[model samples]
Target: MESMLIEKSIQGDVASFEQLIVKYNRYVYNIAFRMMGNEEDAKDMSQEALIKAFKAIGQFKREANFSTWLYRITINVCKDEMRKRKEHVLSYDVENQDEGSMKENIKDESTNPILIYEQLELKETIETALNKLSEDSKAVVVLKDLLGYSYEEIGTILDIPVGTVRSRLNRSRSALKSILQVQLAEQ
Candidate 1:
């Protein structure tokens, strides 16, 4: 099926191209969402990536994974969108931030008012610190620590060397640790 689509798309078959988009829309959107931390930006970046993919279908080489290539485009699109909106207004844009934070997720719900209240402020602080990271670092951090992407796959998707992917992940982890340490010390 993939071979047929590749051949037909290379032959200028728009329907085949559309089929490819349908086949991979979820994947592109997932990558976008993880990188952008929101549904609206994810949807927009995913659509733009699909359009760019269609326009450049002729140049797509089959040796590498097509999904990975599309993932690269979607991530890049998310990064570009983030760059345009460099201000830290995501705190107010709940739709753009991840639904709640780690502390929120771990809040006890079994009628433990004390426990729930204790974690609420900490959760807000952690979420704000995460929002302060650069888009590139955030992408690497989420992909490796949250989504568990290997260095090779991340490098492939980001069009960078594996060493760079590893470096980025290390740097992101260190930055997050420092941010958390400071927050914890203040508490």
Candidate 2:
């Protein structure tokens, strides 16, 4: 079914392409959100990536998975957006905003309240720590850990060697673990 959509979309069928986008929209947005750490930027990047993919459809080879191809486009869009944002250097109130949300989520919980609170807190801590990582590191972490792409699949999506993917993923995980451990200690 996906292969047929890819074939039809590549043949200049606009509706086919639109259908593909609608089908994978959540997946694309999630990748964007994970990479950018914000909803607005993620939406923008996802749209930008889709536009590029539409234009470049002719160049896509059927040998690889369509989702992998889309992943590459999304990652490139995120890299470009990050580059532009680096020039602005705006500081976000990540800590305070997350803490309030964490409290609210934990407060209304009824079952396994302690464990649920700890889990929510940990998720926020990881998100905060992830935001601190460089864009490249964040992409690797998002694709490997959050998205659960296999090592080979991630390597294909990111256009890196499997060994390189493994190394970067290990480094990203190590960095996050260290940062979260420090945050937990401070609490």
TM-score, one value per model: 0.69, 0.80
Clashing pairs in 1: none
Q: Which ten contiguous residues of candidate 2 have the minimum total lDDT?
A: 89-98
Q: Which 10-residue span in candidate 1 carries the lowest summed lDDT?
A: 90-99
Candidate 1 residues 1-187, lDDT tens each? 9878978988888899888778688877877776676688788888898888888878888898888787777878888888788765443222243434633543433443324345677666655566556677777776677667789988988888999998877867656645554455445
Task: State model 1's lDDT.
Answer: 0.71
Error of 1 at 128 (Å): 6.0
lDDT of 2 at 8: 90
Candidate 1 Cα errors over 4 Å, as ranges: 87-130, 180-187
Candidate 2 regions exceeding 4 Å error are: 88-117
Residues 59-175 of candidate 2: C-alpha lDDT, one tens digit per residue: 989898888999899998998888888966333323323445454554464543324347878888888878877777788889888989999998998899999999888877766
